[model samples]
Target chain A: MNDAFSQLHPAASFAFFVAVITLTMLYMHPVLLIISLAAAAGYVCILKGARHFGKTLIYLVPFLIFMSVLNALFNHAGVTPLFYLSNGNAVTKEALTFGFYASVMLSAVILWFECFNVVMTSDKLLCLFGRLSPSVSLLLSMALRFVPKFGRKIRSIDAARAQIGQGSAQGGFIRRVKNSMKVLSVTLTWALESSLTAANSMKSRGYGAARRTSFSLYRFTVRDAVTMVLCAFAVGVTAACVVSGGIYARYYPSVIISGFGGIPALGMAAFALLCFLPQLFDAKEALVWRRLRSAI
Target chain B: MPQTVKKSRVTVTLTVIVLSAAAIAVETWLWSSRKYYLTSVIIILLAMLPFFARFEGRRPQVREIVLLAVMTAFAVAGRVAFYWAPQFKPVCAIVILTAAAFNAEAGFITGAAAGLISNMFFGQGPWTPWQMFGFGLVGFFAGVLFGGREVKTVPMLVYGFFSVLIIYGVLLDTGSLFMYSQEVSLKALLAMYASGFTFNLIHASGTVVFLLLLQKPVLSKLRRIKIKYGMLQ
Candidate 1:
């Protein structure tokens, strides 16, 4: 089943991700970082299967650790020195902690972008920006349409070459590269030659002679409205709390987090809700399906 | 027609200069605020806007649009064909050839389009804008330097090599810096560049190789098409 969250209007999903990613980048608080990271992972697992998510994690975890260690080694800015390398750069606790959290922030952002890719498809992006810049949108659509066609053409050219004993596969690396270039050259000529016909066809069709109208499959329903409003409210609360010093952190000379109080707690809760909103929707949909099956 | 062409050229140039200046201003502010990713992405997008605007305002001939689309598709296809060779793609070389055969505007549009479309197959990420900007800048510069000129294989190959190594490589490394290492210390940046050096070298070599092999044919064909269509003049 299509995830319940992705069924919302593109605007809604786009807004939620923008808010979540922005917050993830800005917030340095460990608790908030963990919450954002977990939420991002969970959302991706729901969107793509857990196996794919796991493969991504296997690649990302080492990268995360490497960045953290590199940061600690290079940045000697903090007060509490844990050790000193031969290069005389003291490994400070604050710097190490800062690096770890910063890496976490980076990981969370990457995962969120993964989710963004899944949810904000090319069609959705085209729909969102089509009217804003019709020429750019048209170029994107045309170029995208041609990419697959060109790929197929390249394959055909390669096959024809192979039949003529000029396959890229039978040679040394340099020879293979040269043979491939031969195929590409043929494709290029054909593409350029065919483009004239395409242009003539477009001209005859009266393209760009009038203002363009775009059609999108998505509609902003009441559910989408609620989602947008809730996301905005959560972001607003988080921003306000951060500005008011209710949610504050420093990891330069030392790690200091502001006391968890009424406003700060509320802000954290709101942020958490915003992060897990997609998962909640997915879970609700699963539960509904379960109940329907049981009733049947 | 010549007068109008000159007029549009002036407007496009003016648009690019003004938007770039504004982008620099906003980039300074965002950099100060440590909003690295947003700053870079916004700056790149702002820089690219004028090209798209020029295409729109000029209401280019159908052939012009088709030429741009075809070249972009070629670049994307080149990239896909060499997917097994990491960082070894002919995108830059193709962009350079397109620019040299046509004008800078065509080159920039082709490069930017290729970047965006290729990423559609590869999956878009935070790196998309950077890749788009980097590839576009390489094409833009190539057009400015070599457009409508005889593309000597050696000089063109040299340009492709250094450009892929420096322009595209540096921009992407800066992207990695912002995304992976939020801290923008000189040391961190150096480290990042160090890690990225081999990849950049491979990418640059790939461009040089492609340029060496494809430059003569690509240029001749493109020029032939230009003569045949009598468009993009």
Candidate 2:
């Protein structure tokens, strides 16, 4: 939790997301995603220690299996089924393959997001946007902040409701439906009150009455410039690939075009993006130290 | 002095001309490869300029920006997650609600921007313009009917439901005709809608229900925003 809390620096998270996405998009091989999945697991263990990692696997494993099964059942492609059904509508190998691929993709994305969720705290995002669009930025940050806070409030509300025998989940369908109206009304009231408070706070600060300026914690350095240049190249290359029909072949070899393909370009972009990772990490460390130093 | 004035005038004229050219080029490409409704983007882009020029406030309203960003995020996320997740039907409903609670123009701009933003995730090809038009149309009119909060339900429900179906139909017809199938006919278009009739019905009905449910809360809240932030003149 300390590690996760420390990681909640939006700039660092942004850099991490940019790097991971660029890399994963460019090198979308099953092998790479698997490696990423492993790497993510390793990082989690390192940060939260072995106990949390173990906790994650127990829940994640069942989810992965469920996702795999659901995708296979629904996809309905390819004729090579592993087992023959009584109706001869057996689950195809392709569907199963797609399912696994989909699962892997989903897991990889989720893993990165877990890291992101840990690092990019709401305060950081709010601070980042406080310049140009104060009201909106405040709303955004507040919304993000409110979600977790509201969630806690709702849990408390639920506990109170449970004591009163007013909790919907414990009741029958019709009763639940009747209870849901109360929940919805309560939640809506909460949202409205929150928005109003946030708006009032803005008004008190003279928000949106005059020109507002935003300040960003992130200072774009030389590394950032180099990284951006590389990303631009990657974007160009991807657009070229799309235009050339290399990425969208309906049938094998029919709509084939030129270039090292989608995955490779994504790699170069990732490489470009990742080249700035050291600076990102350093910046994140410095910010934390600054905060600590100030506190001290 | 006359030359600088001439230059500024020239710059304005040039900006207009360049934008017009871009619109023409985009429309031509879209028409050749996409659909008629797609060309309406050119029209919307033209519409957007006047607002920017007119609303030359030093800073934009925070509430408006926040609303736009949320809608935009939903719009982008919706399309990005389309094949894998539920359509951001809720986002459009929010758009509908926002427009109804505020101004028609607000809805149009928000809807259009949200649609455009959403297409970025899908890697915009041909269908973007029509989707924008669909969302924009819903939003622009939502304000006309519900934007003011006169407190009518049945008319809004009927209006919202048909609006959704029309938007979906427009999208399907444009997309199918221009890109997917060459022999795209109205019958084929209708058939597609018919096949997904239940889904469309549910989607439209659900939106109407959702908006109706949120109408009171959303309107009251937006009124607070306006009063607090001077969002409306």
Q: Write the per-residue lDDT of candidate 1 for residues A95-173, one digit (tens) a residue.
A: 8898888889888988998888888888888888888777777778778888888778888889989998788786788
Cα TM-score per model: 0.91, 0.51
User: Which docking category, incorrect, acceptable, medium or high, applies to candidate 1?
Assistant: medium
State which candidate has the highest TM-score: 1
Candidate number with greatest lDDT: 1
CAPRI class assigned to model 2? incorrect
Shift in Å, residue B75, candidate 2? 12
Fraction of true contacts retained by every candidate, in order, equals 0.72, 0.06
Candidate 2 local accuracy as lDDT?
0.56
